[model samples]
Target: MASRSFKELSFVSIFFSTLATSYLFFPTVFANTHVISIISPLTLVVLDIQGDGFTAMEYVYSTVLFFATSIILFYVGITNFREERLFSEKPLTSRLADFVSAGVSRDHPHLSLFLLAGFTIPFVFMAQMLTLVLFFNIPMPLSLVLLTVSAAFIEEFAKSIGLYAVARERPGFLTPRNLLLAAVAIGSGFLVGEKLLLFATLAQITESIFGSVLFLSLQVLWMPLLLHITGVLITGGFLLLWGRQGYGPGLIAACTVHSLYNLHFLMGALL
Candidate 1:
């Protein structure tokens, strides 16, 4: 028990140290003359009085911060679960299942969905950062494939985390009617959060073809909302039909559908 405690302590110390190191070194990556602007809607509007938009460094730093925060929160979540003595003689997968099942608030489905919506923002930002980093310099067709697949995987996984957390947390929650309502709630929450973030920090990107593809901005707002709803329903349906073991397959199914949706837009942009 002592050895396990020491190992956990060491791991935490290393994680924080790495985070601090990243913070210290981050400024060195960009020019000293670069003005640091907060990525809020008001800040952007105020700073762009001269018509000069956000700098690349601003976006980079914001993305890095979001990605870092997500990682830290994920670690904290696992630690909290461990502290609750949730881990037992069960296999790793079983422990993970238990963790997911217990992570959400009991009897508070609305609150869980709301929190999940907020939780997804950082993860989606992380996904955008990763997609850009991985496919920045790659050529057209290959980059398109990679970008679509990676984005789909990340976004679907993010949505799935919320779905499973709520669906598996209690009995009768995974029923068809309940899952349908949960899917709608989760999708609506995600859509609102996603659009707000885009309006605040990513409005500029919407002007470009790549941004259009990434954000899936269409003439009608309902399309994106519908897409999100459809994606959640696909996953939720799998869970409803297959029971607890359905999450993995459901996530994969959602990812596949999302990938196809993204690919269609990407192809249209290319042509």
Candidate 2:
């Protein structure tokens, strides 16, 4: 009876917690309303200054959007702070890979380079497809993404750096699952930033309630999952190769890939 009552209380707590989360953390409805309310005035401003004005507005809007989007992720991270302990637990010698990853003298530089090329090369193929689409002027946005896709090759390799970093810092976090979690956690932070940008844009641009919700949910799930895994792969690879060589190379590789993905679209805009 006591356990049953406790379970009921837990359920009620979770229900209310989720409801509060929705109320507090949700930006979709508010963002949409704000955009709709402001669009006419914004449009007027845009007509006066045209491209420069629009660009400036975008910067402001993007910043606002990112802030709102990050709020949700921050809330989630705060709630899940206990999960981070997963990185702090475990036996020492079992983390031999972690030490090697942290830069033990016994590691090889070439192995690191090989890790980079391996993760990056597959992404290069994806980028090639993107480049091909761009060259042909395909209707798909894929063309605008070639450069970013190209960088994926390096990004996945860099995920291993997180493992090495945490391992060097704590070592037992070298397991594949924990490594994946770290990537997810870090990537969630990034996606929250992305979610904010998307929200701000949608708030400014669209009004379809069902469509917007679907879009928001999909973006939140898919992009983070893909990105986190990418981090895991690259960083994980480096840890495997260098063990305790530390994560400098892995980090460089991951960031390189990330830069490629975002820059890929940027290149198109410039062209």
Candidate 3:
């Protein structure tokens, strides 16, 4: 009875949290309503305003709330899965440890590349929200430093997600040859998605100083492509060599390399 009650509570929590999170992404779903009620983490009523827009503080708070609720939803869902035996019998942390250490997987390189390409859209959206929140609330050189580190971590972690997914489903794909192939595919996918996004929605920023730095624009087309490919290779190489224990150190190494690259561009822009 207790377990059933907990499951029901978890389901309700997830459903509402998911609904609130979706609102963050697409508020237009509620555009027809005049009374706007803002809920954070699905339960707390943060604000009730009769306007379409938000104050700067409200916006920041809402973004933070979104992050909180997203985390809650993920945790609740994972716990529910564990309770339902959908996941292995191991504890959640143990399962996660094994998952990361399980190594990489294999698939058709073309298909893998194509599927992974779309991941950049979500990654960019996440990074944009994070960037806006930081730049809005923080000041000066500190903000710049945080932005550089945050951006690098987000992008590198985004690529790692795709690699981890592949590893989870496809065993024996962690060979040196396969790692190189996967790295190439992931990098190519990210390049394609990023360019498409820029061409479609972010064209205006391409000429701005920050835009040039953010996108790593270069006259030589191959430069950005090579950079991304090399970045992923650094992470993938670590995973290939260290098995399950390599992901954290690998991510840190990749982020460090990426951060240096971004910092160089940003400093040049500032100068």
**Top candidate, metric lDDT:** 1
lDDT string for model 2 (1-271, tens) is 1112456558667865764344333332233334332222333344345443445565454344335435633543453344333253334333323333333222433333233223222222222222332223334345434334443443343334334544566555557665555555545543444354445454443344222321222333775457555866676657756776635677667667665545544544456
- Model 1 worst lDDT run, 10 consecutive residues: 28-37
- Cα lDDT over the full model 3: 0.56
Q: Candidate 1 on 1-271: residue-level lDDT in tens?
A: 1113456658667876764454344332322222222322233444477476667655654554456466757754764555444435544444444555554666777566755665576658545644544464578668768777887787777777777765655657778777777777777777787766666666655564545566763445787677777888888888888866887888888889888887887677677
Across 1-271, the per-residue lDDT of candidate 3 in tens digits comes to 1123456558667866664465553432323331122212121222333344445554443344345446644643554454333435555444543443322223364355445544444445445543533353357677667767777777787777666555544546667787777777777777777766555444433454434545653334576667677777887777778865787898899989888987887787778
Could you tell me how far off, in angstroms, the CA of residue 219 lies in candidate 1 after the best superposition? 5.2
Q: On lDDT, who's better, 1 or 2?
A: 1
Query: What would the TM-score be for candidate 2 when compared with the true structure?
Result: 0.33
TM-score of model 1 (CA atoms): 0.70
- The residue ranges of model 2 lying beyond 4 angstroms of the native Cα positions read 1-165, 201-220, 244-271
Candidate 1: residue 175 lDDT (0-100): 80
TM-score of each: 0.70, 0.33, 0.62
lDDT, candidate 2, equals: 0.43
Report RMSD for candidate 3: 8.7
Give the residue spans of candidate 3 off by over 4 A: 1-110, 168-171, 204-213, 217-220
Ranking by lDDT: 1, 3, 2
Model 2 alpha-carbon miss at residue 171, Å: 2.4
